[model samples]
Target chain A: MSFLGGVDTSNGVVLDPECSLIGESVRGRILCFPFGIGSTVGSYAMYQLKLNKVAPRAIINRSAEAIVATGAIMSEIPMVDNVDTSLIKSGDRVVVDAANGTVEIRDVTERHVVTSILRNRGRVLILKRSDKVGSYRGSWAGVSGFVEKDEGDEEAARREIVEETRFTNARLSRRVPARGFRHNDSVWTVHPFLFDVSSRDVSIDWEHEAYAWILPGELKDYTTVPGLGAVMNDLLSRTSP
Target chain B: MHLTKDEEHVLAGEEGAARQKAMELLVSLGDIYGAERLIPVKSAQVSGASFKTIGDAGIQWLEDMSEGTRASVPSMVNPLGLDMRRWRSMGVSPDFHGKQARIVAAYRSMGLLPVYSCTPYLAGYRPRRGQHLAWAESSATVFANSYIGARTNREGGPSALASAIIGKSPEYGLHLDENRLPKVEVNLPSVPEGLVPLAGYTAGKVAGNRIPLISGQAFAEDEHKSFGAAMAATGAVSMYVSKGTVGHVRSRGIDRSMIEERVTISSRDLRRCAEELSGDDEWDLVAIGCPHSSTRELAHMARKLKNRRPRRNCDVWFCTSRMVHSRCPQHIATLRRFGKVLCDTCMVVAPIEEMYARTATNSGKAMVYLPTLGRQTASFRTTDQLLEAISR
Candidate 1:
């Protein structure tokens, strides 16, 4: 959002070397990004884009920050936020209904998966996936598996915990709605769960190689799955009391 | 969100195109922040007035928006990149001045007052207690909300302009009484001479987005200007309440039980901040008045320098609003011996990087921007220290 350095208003290209969309032209295209960063004057940069006839046709963001929102309104550009921006691609045609605050991506599919966390006392269990697993092999993750068709999220969570950790006596403490993440072409809608167990002991199966009981603060030290720490924090903190 | 019939008509594009666009901006922002309705504001202070900051694209947008738009309330503009009368002497090229003049013309055509100062409250547009405003300049918004006992969210430039055109803003954030209550208590030991801005800078980092209740020091109105300017520069919150009699809080129905964080800023901490902010002493430019100098500040500097002779070794600028500049002509004449008494511009938004490599300023807000926006190696000094350095 550096109006002075990051954008070339005349050509509608992102000139910022640090920007992910460097050299990309926003002209007549629906621009989708997480949110704007940098100066408040970045709002003016957006207006500049419109003046040059290089402004984005529409804007979609994960969340609406004030700067970009102000810019879009001032420039008369249609915009919507609180959308899963990862489901959008560069060439994907986006229809932004700012009045309803929704964005629809023309061609993309969403897949749902259940990721369950097993907690014993104060520590949560982290399992390393086996190489024989479908995706993210050798990566540390929560007890996870794809949701079977027609299965409830909680029922799927219980099944995954029993199959991955062999903990049949685990009680479901908390369950949160699914969150989406973009991986290659498919959108992973991870339904998170926190289960309390009586013991730290676990029986590993063919899907996992090793397991460890680590404090939640130490989740950053290990290379786990995407959004694992966030999912764990949300589930654990909500059910703490 | 609920909209009245008139508001709905404007949103539905029943009104003229400009007013409809303004209504749409307000309505969408209201939706984003979950504001229940739009409230009328007494005034607005719009930023992004400078050509150096906004550039060619800004000129184009302003020209387009100016076609049919006019301010519904009393609105003032922020500082431009150069003094309108003295651009030739300030080292601003003709090309930049031409672009800047177009911006000024556009704003003037839109019915904005030509008080190109960040301290619009000081320059005749002061709002009363309990009045709501849609001010954009961070320093002015903080001053209006905290010191003047007004209500306003820190608005962006275009939103504030929209508010000016329609005379209404989204009722959210600081406009709500519940959000005005102090969530953190900041205790300060006696702030050293010329370190008040640093204390504010430190307080901002400690408070983050929470409204801080400051205790243990009495500050004058001018000190509040510098302190609050620095606080808003570093922190996300627009208002802070001091414990002293000055700028007292009207905590009518607020619950004080939510305060969980208490921070103490000691003399050692201030010293550390000063040491960390102090850069090289040798500077090509020594500029002051980041929030724009008040009349009293101009007179004080004039009194101090009236007896001393100018060294004239390096460039010096005494930045202030034209209104204040007009009020202190004798002071301006005396200070002009030392350096240029610049108006409608300060070191932060000016194109100082193209002219000077190193700069020194006393303002904590300037210390944050001079390095990044001005692209100069910055040196932090007190006003007295900077004045003494630039004088014989």
Candidate 2:
């Protein structure tokens, strides 16, 4: 048997008509597919699962969303990411070893290559984004986007920086391996490569309105992704040579 | 920052396991922020509940890892009120119980007051800006650092409690009064006329993440609660909720109809402002009791519901202090029949997943709305108006 655990990491409520069935079927089941979506307030619901002692024993994710990951980490639930959710189904018994960050399905069909990006920052080559992309369309961001078929994840990230920001001569740092998660058809990878751009190399893409060389303290002006901000904060704190 | 001799000793394993663990965590955090020396803190307001209760092991690990050193700061805590009897009946796992007991034991041993609500300000732990406090209320943090001008980082539960125990937090961000300066400023046209709660919500939307020094309104103290609740609701991270009332309006016999009309427009403007300020959905949780609902408000809820009947499937909880709860147990059945009357805890303070309300509405216009604090983001409106929404 295979199971698809419908986990929501929102701080708000995800009201579904078939909530009871999903809740029961998914418990102790192979948590499957996609990063939990919906309201950030759903974070509280995740908390409630622990309070009532009915939380999913383990989580299988395309990628860990910020609130969910933070909440799960804070709550200490086992979770594993980067595994294809398609192999798991509506009813499957599974044991999730979150401490080691792995998952074992009772009867799995196939496996896919799952990579996670460990992003580090020195001078995050920020791109002044334009309105072409939806969401934060005309804002600043680090090298970000999805890894297309055949193209390497690193190439895609660097290409995205160039395509979005029009930077060409900056040196590419080591590729921080990461995964891409599609929560409800939105597929983006977890890996972001770090690069150091010279003063002359810094330029704004039509995608972004402007760019800045900001320290961790100054990065607050531009709203980067939530967990990413915390990550950058950690990097900023590390002792440098 | 230099660790106190006591803190240093803890770091070196002079103290027992709990203190060692807690201090080690603090030192790492301090090193990250470049805090040279640790300072003492008077009080701390902590957030986050037990791993057992929250059911997420990741959260549990984070809690345990951060709780390494039992810092010696006076602290205020959010309620993790677990009815163990109820859990046993549900056949809850023992692992969950053990994790929760560890946290509870830690707090109790530290002499931390486990009030368990996010709105410590209501519980009388208001730390004015620059007051040398260690707090973990997200909305309260925003309110204190931005509005009240208190200093704090968005420190998580363990560090926040530790700082309160040791009486010091890293002097960064809001701690440096200069960082608390208002980057964005908003001005209101006039006081709300009708359903002041709606007007307060409007103010929250307009003031998101910006410092709003309000003008042009006169409100009773109860009304101020409404405004604060609404501001926090609409996502104004911080606010200087001052009296904008002009004496002439009341003295000259201001027409009630005119005031109501302005209040309506103000509420709409608030929604518009919130949309403009926020990036994502701009959605948040609507919470009441920033300072906790005043005793008079609780009394009013009890009296009103005293003669009324409960709406089917509608949960109207009245959160207040224990002092207020003791005054009206006889009305408990009536209140529960309609809604829950929770004491020493409010929706924003305690985890309300069981309440099953994704979005909550309240009445007021000061700075009560804090979606993040509620653990569920929110939308704000006045109490009477919200009652209509909930009923519908």
Candidate 3:
């Protein structure tokens, strides 16, 4: 959000008509937006908010621009950027630790899940989750499950792969850092792993009703779970190196 | 962005809160732009000083920063909303004058020079060739890069102020050698005598964000001033390579392989632009300078109206910097017979909307701003035309 003419300093009301939170007061609130996109005088307008005692308690941006950064420092407002602002919604209680560069949603719980992509030949395996599954029913996903308290990410990935696909001779090919997605009150942090197998044979478990072994390019034809496409792209981009 | 030990110390607040905040601002900007480090700046010219533009928040911010900080470099300010010494004569309210005074006091306490004009290159703070500056005024940034071979990105008001306090700017954008190359070529047609600024206005529209290598006509120094100001206003670029300043661009190593994109700005386009901005002749005020007039422009304008008598047809504002105004007393006196020779402010920065609704200006830059910022039905005219309009 821009401060200059885009917001009213007197009451902290977002004046930009294009903004989603238009007419909503930002005073004493933790304001989250994409980034500032207006005049450099926006910095001064933000300072005016502080002078008028109508400033937000803290600011969270997907990315910070020069105008908002300058205003945040000049006005002594706590600002943290490079956050996934789409996770934050109105009325969500959030705590911003500016110095530590972290944001915490007070009421939201983070769930860790292990998703392993089993590759045989040039085809990647995708499973259609059964209706009996507790979450993401009738949706396509990789060999995914929850991580137990005693297991590391890799151990959980191997365990989920064996339980879901009955594959024991899969070799670890690639692993990347976990990526997070927000869904309702839960933050799903998915740890993705790629495993190369010698055979495409698998005994299906009750967790899935159907299975498909398809090329990575054809994965988009099916409806998959959230962020599954991105996970596949990330894992497959460095398969050779 | 990597900060040196000394820079880290400043950012760590060992240098005090004001300096720490200034360093923090610089570091943030450096990180955002993906710069390796901060480089020392020769000078800084900060904008957003006017009360009309900044209002109470800017004054308060300056007051807060002024408590324990001073400018490390020779910093100059953009024009205030009114002439600091003669706002009463310009029909400014006392409340506005009070706010403007506080802003002036805040800047003065911070050791910033009150050279309150956008054309600081003409007002005694001209940078040397190849010198780095943190200038926030669009016109001055354009002029410094295009005319004097100086390097500066078009900085924001607060970023420029932070650079003034820290005496350093992020080494990115125009500060780097590779970013200065002209990406587009603009071939100008035979521009009329009075349509130089309009030619610039047209060229800027075609240039967009790319720096244009302007060919065709040779422009005087004043022409560069007017041309670049208009370009900076219309386009996102702060620099251009014209016939006169091509030497500066060549010194930075021209890359012809990157100049595949080209655009042509014709005289007919400039004439059309002039016609579109040329509103009714019945104006409430006629303003001369947008990027404060230099001594030569003042002399030229004064010479044009030396023998002509004032018709008292409309309110007139001959804007120039205070330094230039003091230097050209004879020209000032002659122009005063026609209108108020205002110093430290111009028609664009002033609260003209409060006094005049339909304004006329000779500046192409003012043509972009007078209608929106000044809230006036603006009429575009040349220097000769504006002078002729004010004087019989």
Top-lDDT structure, candidate number: 3
lDDT string for model 3 (A120-139, tens) is 98999999999999988988
Candidate structures ordered by TM-score, highest first? 1, 3, 2
Please identify model 2 stretches exceeding 4 Å from their true place.
A1-241, B2-6, B31-36, B50-71, B81-106, B124-130, B142-154, B191-209, B218-291, B303-313, B327-338, B348-360, B363-381, B386-392
Candidate 1, superposed: residue stretches over 4 Å from native: A1-4, A89-95, A115-172, A194-232, A239-241, B245-256
TM-score of chain A of 1: 0.88
Chain A, model 2: TM: 0.46
Give model 1's share of reference contacts.
Answer: 0.81
**2 versus 3: better TM-score goes to:** 3
Candidate 3: DockQ? Answer: 0.70
Q: By DockQ thresholds, what CAPRI class is model 1?
A: medium
DockQ for candidate 2: 0.05
Tens digits of per-residue lDDT for model 3, B1-392 = 98899999999999899899889899989988889999999999999889999988888888888888999999999998998788999988999989999999999999999899999888888898789999999999999998898999999988999999999999999988688778889888678778888877877888899888888888999999999999888888999886657424466545555686887777787788888989987999999888889899999988999999998989899898999888989999999999898988888888999999999988899999999889999999988988888888
Candidate 1 clashes between residue pairs 3 or more apart in a chain or in different chains: none
List candidate 3 stretches off by more than 4 Å: A113-130, A136-179, A190-241, B1-6, B205-208, B246-253
